[model samples]
Target: MANFISNAFMIPNDLIDKGYMKKMKGSALPCYVLIVRNTRGWNKTTDSMSISQFVEQTGYNKDTVLKGLNTLEELGVIAKKSSKNRASEYTLTDSIIAVDFLDSEKLDSEILDSENGSGSEKLDSKMGSGVENLDKLLSKNSTHNNNIKTNTKTKGNFSEEFEIFWNAYPTCKRKSDKSGTFKTFEKYTRVISLEKLIAILNAFKMDSQWIKNDGEYIPAPSAWLNKKHWENDFWLKAAGLVEQQPQSAETPEYANPQRRHIPTMPKRFKGMNA
Candidate 1:
């Protein structure tokens, strides 16, 4: 029985007849196919797509998708135009590229002759370059991700820090949102240094607002962090007092007019400047 496909789209015979397939040896082939599907499959002359969309559809990384698109552009297989803050618009040069897994092998003389020496060597070289490029992309991506991982504390370490903070918070009438509080703790510490945040937490330990009636009115840790209570003055002083501005050393004169001294007319006003 012959191979058959029912749910299909058309692929331009020129795609094979003109030998564009041979030049699109590596990442470019799949990228072109993706474009074909989006444009020709949808029965539209043009469609917009992004690197992310190609990555998702083809399961290729960003670099691979970019390389494929570049190759297709260079080959004049597609026309791509950038749209600001949107996916690039793509126009497939070929009109009928949607075929049901058709035997492209039978249609191409070079592919049919691929079993012979010269054709086989070219295919190998083309595939070799593809693999090499893919490896390089993966290596670079891994290195970048590793560098970020080095600076970031692991989840286990973060959880430990959160446990310490949770223990130090004042016990209230009822606690809530332990999991959510952990999340807020991460964000809170990002803006307010953990050292200062902890200091504020400790200061609020004996705060009248937090401790009145045995911590009855104290908010949950998540709520407190969300409200940014660490910015409150209650945490800055020994007795939950608002910090006071330093007073000037100069003495303030009494405001009472009764205390004013009457100079005896400056001793007759110096006799008119005698």
Candidate 2:
């Protein structure tokens, strides 16, 4: 199970969607592609896994495995051995696309077994929406960079999913407290970098809320903070971070009374005390 999980689960669906697994979807082509990809890295040398062997290992029918292998070969995602006895050895055509194979499946909870509730696909879809937008704001690029590293990856070389789940800050556990100020802050901690956290905090004169507390700072209750977006924007700007203009007139980032803004520091006289 360790080898199976390691070999099968480690691959990203993003790589597959990026055309890595474009070979063929007939039969168990996807399964075979996954098997071959898991077994070999970019330096594709002559590697072979037979139909019978693949079926035995995966518990799929022999015909299904054969169909998948042939489909993969047809798509040019892999090259087969010239000789039949070698059990149809395959080679990767493109590593980048193949890398995305890990991202191919959406991982919807309904599709997975219920025991552990590895509903990662749902979690990713939810978090990714925010991360993707944030990346657009930061990078100013929208071409869809295939290898965009999340905040989790910047910290280490661990598997992306592990980093996302274990290393990254927790996001789901606190969503129930929508009125909580730390909601976004909590979400950001998981994906935001130490540098970005520092910058944003220094800009606001507030401390970054980390998953673990070293006794230096504590998260204030949500009530202590203002609900204005412009004010936050002002703080962000003070920290040298750019704020995007809110898209709708109804957004709270504006300065109008209808829309909340960050409070400005009051003016004062130098020698007013009696």
RMSD of each: 20.9, 24.8
Tens-digit per-residue lDDT, 1-274, candidate 2: 3333211223445445555445445455555544544344222334544444455445567787777776666655566676532345556554333222233454344346434565655655645564555434425531222233453245223332222222122233332343244444454445545334444433333335432354223334232223332246676676566767666756554444464587999997699668
lDDT of each: 0.62, 0.44
Question: Worst lDDT window (10 residues) for model 2?
Answer: 160-169
Q: Which of the numbered candidates is closest to the native, going by highest lDDT?
A: 1
- Index of the highest-TM-score prediction: 1
Q: Candidate 1 — number of clashing residue pairs? A: 9
In model 2, the runs with Cα more than 4 Å from the true position are 1-16, 19-26, 41-45, 95-274
Residues 11-82, candidate 1: write the lDDT tens digits: 556678767788886678888887765554434557766565576567677888888889888887688999
